[model samples]
Target: MKRAQHFIGVAVAAAAVIGVTSLVGNDYYLRIIFMMCVYYLCAAGMNVLVGFAGQKSLGQAGLFAAGAYAVALLTTKTEISPWLALIAAAAISGVCGVLIALPSLRVKGPYLAMVTLAFGIVVEKLVGEWTEVFGGAQGIYGIRPITWNDQPLTSQQWVWFAVVLCALAHLLLRNLLQGRFGRALLSLQADEIASASVGVRVYRAKVIAFVVAAVTCGIAGALVAQQNQYINSDFITFHLSIFILLLVLFGGAGSMYGPLIGAVILTAVDAALARWPSAQHFLYGFLLLFALYVMPGGVAGVFRALFKERTETEAGEKSEEPPKTTRIGPAGEGELLAVEGVTKAYGGVKPAQNVSFRLQRGHIHALIGPNGAGKSTMINMLTGVVKPTSGSIRFLGQEIAGKPAHLICSMGMGRTFQNLRLFSDLSVLDNVMLGRHTRMRNGFFSSLMGLPVAGRQEAVTRGRALELLELVGLAHLAHQPAGSLPYGLQRRAELARALATEPQLLLLDEPAAGLNPHETAELGQQLLRIGRCGVSILMVEHHMDLVMSVSDHVIVLDYGIKIAEGKPAEVQCNPRVIEAYLGVDDEDDIEARETCPPSEGRRDAET
Candidate 1:
């Protein structure tokens, strides 16, 4: 049904384009329309980099210049066909994009802006100074127009060609962005840390965005090469780059039609004010300022706000219950993780020291301690968020202490953060979908091309994401942003997202940190349910009541050292647990191994 609606919208837009072509015969009007299509082609891809990927590239004119030169030099020097030139231009610019991305993608935000801006200035100055072949500031000329049937294409014909190019580019880009590839980019923009935790390659996504932006601008530059039959440094300036960027931002950065609508309005306005150059400049700047200041969300954003989807109130229906899981026992031989004297030091201070423990398959093992304790550090070392020093950490019979976080995640372990790290801007469902990144086999190319495997995987993940949401009792709000949910629901959403990774062991850090008594009770139920899904759990928490209720085994840490490990009752009875929580007067007091009554430590640990 959704695909059908998408096709219907496409048909409607196609009809509108054909209508404009058939009725408008004025040569000047056709030129404006052609320019609009040119801008549309470039702006569409800009939305991906700037809007969805949330990386700034302020020097797209360099990419445009690369393509433009590819076309101009190829056509004028050799006798290459103009259409062939266009394809070559796109390829050349793609390489240029990769070159820029190598260094630029290493940094982000204003640093990226400086890199790209430098790239643009360098390209412009190079084109102007290399007078021997480029004709310097004058640029290349005598370029052949894109011809139809061996004759130069008419204004009407060129406009139609541009329209076709714009339509095709828009369709492909829109398809990619609306799929998993786009979702991952959106995930990156929202929170890089959260995105990485879900297995997103942060730098790779940024590079892909830059490459796509370059390819589109390159294609647009090819069209310009043909239209004017002359190239100049002045034409491909930083101002034009800003103009193209404004087209995306002025319309709606991430939306499909934003570029098209922005291109049409701005191109037409520029052509209309052609008689007065000074006024044209003033009005153009004013419009950009107006779009940025008055309508910050852009034209498409404003339109979306006006016609936002009505909140769906229909409750989510329950599906068949998940089958119960087997909880491993301390006596069981199926051990999932073993840490032997694992320790992590930061310069002078050691947060985790000589810690050792083993978790059996499908067991709920809890790590407990007070604020300054080393529980958090131990979990990080286990999950590869931090590497250990002078110790061994093994998961599934393999050493994994120094592996990358995503590699550990792919190895069937999932975890949540101490303070909750949800991608607040993404929809509730998207958060879970991103968690399945390691499960996906498609890379940027396969997904960008919208291959069958990518599509199949996407559909499968979407269904599974909804199912996970349903499990968390949030399927009804799948379309809503994850951050907008209530505090308790947000935590539950994080659980669903983590579970989406299909891990053998789940690590939860402070899951019950801020919940009320009633909410805490609900949390206990949720943990029990999750345990029944055939997954083991490793938790670092301070909520003693909640921990004692659910944890089958407990490990206590204090000042980076393991104090005790046993069943919940045994750890609760240990005097060291009390000393760690309430404090000990001297280092010897903790080392002396004093014994105390069971009830005293249990109450203080709970407090």
Candidate 2:
């Protein structure tokens, strides 16, 4: 049903573009439409970065210039076809994208923005000062126009070319943004720590987004070279990149129509302000400010609001039945993880000291401690989110100490944060698919192209994620924004996401922290089901009822040291654990002490 709506929306948009292009009666209007398409291409690329991946790259002008220069140089210096030149431009831009991505993505926020800004400046200067090749600001002229049927393309042919190119770009981006790759990028944007925990290589996702956006802008630049039959260094400017960004943002960064709407509206605005040439730049700046203030989500957001069809998420539609939960399989049995003498110390402050534990397959082990006892830190060490100051950690017989979190995840360990870390902007289904990142076999190219194998893999992944969601009773809300779910449900969703990794060992940090009694009971059942499947469970939780009920083995921690390790009942009765952790004194009265009461009262009576 949703896919059908997507196709319907695309058809409507394409028909609208075709209809508008057909109705343009003169060369002047034809040229306007052509320019609009060019800008549309640039805006769409920017959207992939800023909208989908949440990367703020202000150097797209540099990428655009690279593309134009590649096209211009290839066509003028050799007999290469313009189509081939465009592909070359894309490749060139992609290389440049990697260069920028490696250094810039290392830093974030304004620092990252400055890196891209500096890159644009550098590109502008290289073309201007490197006189030998770039023709020194005069740029390359008389570049071959796109020839159709062995002749110069007519104005109508040019328009059709623009339409086709824009349509193809739209189709490609649309498919990607709705697939596993897009989900990975979106997950990266939401929370890097959580993303890594779910097996997304944070750096790789960023680089892919950066390259895709750059290639899109480069393609647009090639179109510009073909349309004008000339290129100038001055044609690519920092201001041009800024305008393209504004166009994308003003239209709606993440939406399919965002770039087109922004391009069309801003193109018309530019034409309207042409007569007031001196004030045009100022007018554009003013308009950008206005749009940011009044319509922060852009024109697409406005359209959605007006039609009351604004999307929260594609997956979160109303469902008739409650979500179901799945039973874990027996394929995950045996000794899954072992930690020996693991210690993590910060500035001589020890959070974990010689914490040694082994998790046998299919057992639910509970790590319980009070605040500052380092339960969370221990979990982080196990997942490789934190490197143990000293010790050996092994998972499935592999040394995993200091391994990257994503690599550890790929080794079949899945975890949930003590604080819920979910991708708020994505659907519940997307969050679960994120857990399947390591499981996915399709690469960016295959996924974008929707190849048969990619489709089959995606179906398998989606089916698995849905089944996991059902186990947590969230299948009904699979399409809902994960953040929009209730606190208890978010915990369920988090569990489902971790389970989606198909982990032989699952580490849950406070899985039942915010659930009601009933929910907590259900969660225990869920954990038991997961355990029965042969998946080992290690959880740090404050809920004793939950911990005692679900856990097969219980370990007590006090001030970063293990105080007791035994069966849940034995650990509960251990005096050292009661004194150091449970805050219980032996002599406390039965009525007050039997169910565990105030420590102060017992001390007062004894004193």
Candidate 3:
């Protein structure tokens, strides 16, 4: 349904373009339109990397220059067909993108920006210095125009060709963004840590985004070369790179139509200001500032905000439903997770040392100690986010100590963070959808081609995600952004997301840390319900009441070593457990507690 809507929208847009082109037949107007399309294509390509993939690259000008020169050199010197040279230009630019991305991957933020900026300068200089092929700073001229079937194409025809290519590029990019790779890029942009935890290969995704962006830019470069029948280093300058970046930002980075809107507006302004040279620069700068101040989210963002508000208003009229309670089955009896001789040290400080424990399936097992007890460290090791110095972790009989977090998750181990690693920018449903990503077996091509299997998989995943949200009492907030939810609700949503992976073993780190007593009690009940549903839970919690109520077994750790382990009742009375909690023991009080009735004794011991 969404695909059909997008196609219809594109068709309408194409018709509008045709109408505008036919009505405005002036050569200057035609040229401006053609330039606008080319600019849009370039800006859209950059958006894929900076907006979606979350990588900053200022080297697009270098890739664009490479593509232009490739076409110029091939057509002028090698007698290669212009069409064939265009393909070669895209391929060469893509290779350059890979080369640039390989090193840029190791650097990020301002450093990456500097590296790519340097790349652009280097390419420009190289083109000027290598005069033999490039025709020096004057550039190559008299480049043969593209022709079809031995017929010379007119200027208007070339303009139409550029427009069609631009439209195709826009459609292709929109489709790519709607697919798996697009989701992965958006996921990375939203939260790299959470993305990696869910098994997104961050480096690989960034490189692919870079290459895809370069390829699109290369195509745009070829069109420009064909349109002009001449090329020069000035056409692909550092300023052009900055201009494209600004276009992307002004259009709204992630929106498909942002680049088109930005390009048309900026290009028209530039063309209009051409006669007034004195004020052109200042006027353009002032306009850019105004746009930045008035529409920071850009044109696309304005529409998105309006759409979101309308959606919320409509949803507000729906009947409210009570929170759905989880229906967990009986806790499994066998061991679900095992850590043997696991040790980890950081700069000689032992965070976890020889930690060994077995967690029973379907049980809420708590690992508690003071601030430095390695409780969190142990959890990290088990989840594959951190590697143990020496030890092995097994989940359901398979070793998973040093594997990537995503692989561990794929093996049915799901975890929530103490600091809240939810994708705050995504809606509640989208957040949970990310957890179900591994279950999606369809590839990028499969989604683009809209194969039957991919369609079924997408539908199943969406339904399952909705069900998981319902299970956690968050279905009502499905459309709400994760960051906007109340803290307690956000935590619940995180739990729902983890469960969406359908893990056999769930690791929750402090699910009730900041909740009020009422909320804590509700959380305890939820944990018990989850345990009943056949998910073995390993929890690190400071709330003794919540832990004692839900946990079937408890393991005590002190200064990176296990102090004691037993059933909740047995471990509560152990001398070391008392010392770990209270620091000092009262012998008379211990005896008094031991003498009390079992239920009363447990309550007294808890206090």
CA RMSD, predictions in order: 3.4, 4.4, 3.2
lDDT of 3 by residue, 1-607 (tens): 4877877877788778877787776888888888888888789889899888878888889988888888888888888888898899999999988988887557887798888889899998888888877876788987766897876566677777777777777777776676556777888888776786666677788888888888888878877887788888778777678778878878787888788878988888878877885576676566557657987777888888888654452322322565454442334578788889999999889989898999877677888776778988998898888889999898889999898888888888888998998888778888887787778898766765666767687788778778777776777779888888888888988998888777888888888878888888988887877776778888898877777788888888899999898877777777677666665556776565543333544443332
With a 3 Å backbone cut-off (N, CA, C), the pairs that clash in candidate 3 are: 328-532, 328-533, 329-532, 329-533
Q: List the residue pairs that clash in candidate 1.
A: 325-532
Candidate 3, residue 21: Cα displacement in angstroms equals: 1.9
| lDDT comparison, 1 vs 3, better candidate | 1
Candidate 1, residue 367: the lDDT equals 91
Q: What TM-score do all the candidates reach, one by one? A: 0.91, 0.90, 0.91
Position 132, candidate 3: lDDT: 79
* Candidate 1 structure, TM-score to reference: 0.91
Q: Order the numbered candidates by lDDT, best leading.
A: 2, 1, 3
Q: lDDT of each model, Cα atoms only?
A: 0.82, 0.83, 0.79
Per-residue lDDT of candidate 1, residues 72-139 (tens digit): 99999999898898899999998988888887546877898888889999998888889777678878
Q: What shift in Å separates residue 304 of candidate 1 from its native position after superposition?
A: 0.9
lDDT of 2 by residue, 1-607 (tens): 3655866776677677777777767988888888898899889888888888788888999999989999999999999998888899999999999988987546986788889999999999898889899986787897887787889887766887788788778877877877888888788778889999999898988998889889988888888887888888878787897898899888997888889999999999888777886677887687678778988889998887788643454333434665453554346457778889989899989998998888887789999877888999999999989998999999989999999999999888999998999898787898998899899898888877767777788899999998888777777788777888878888888888999887878999988777888888888888887777667889998887777777889888888999889887777656666676545434553234335433433222210
Query: What is the lDDT for 38 in model 2?
Result: 88
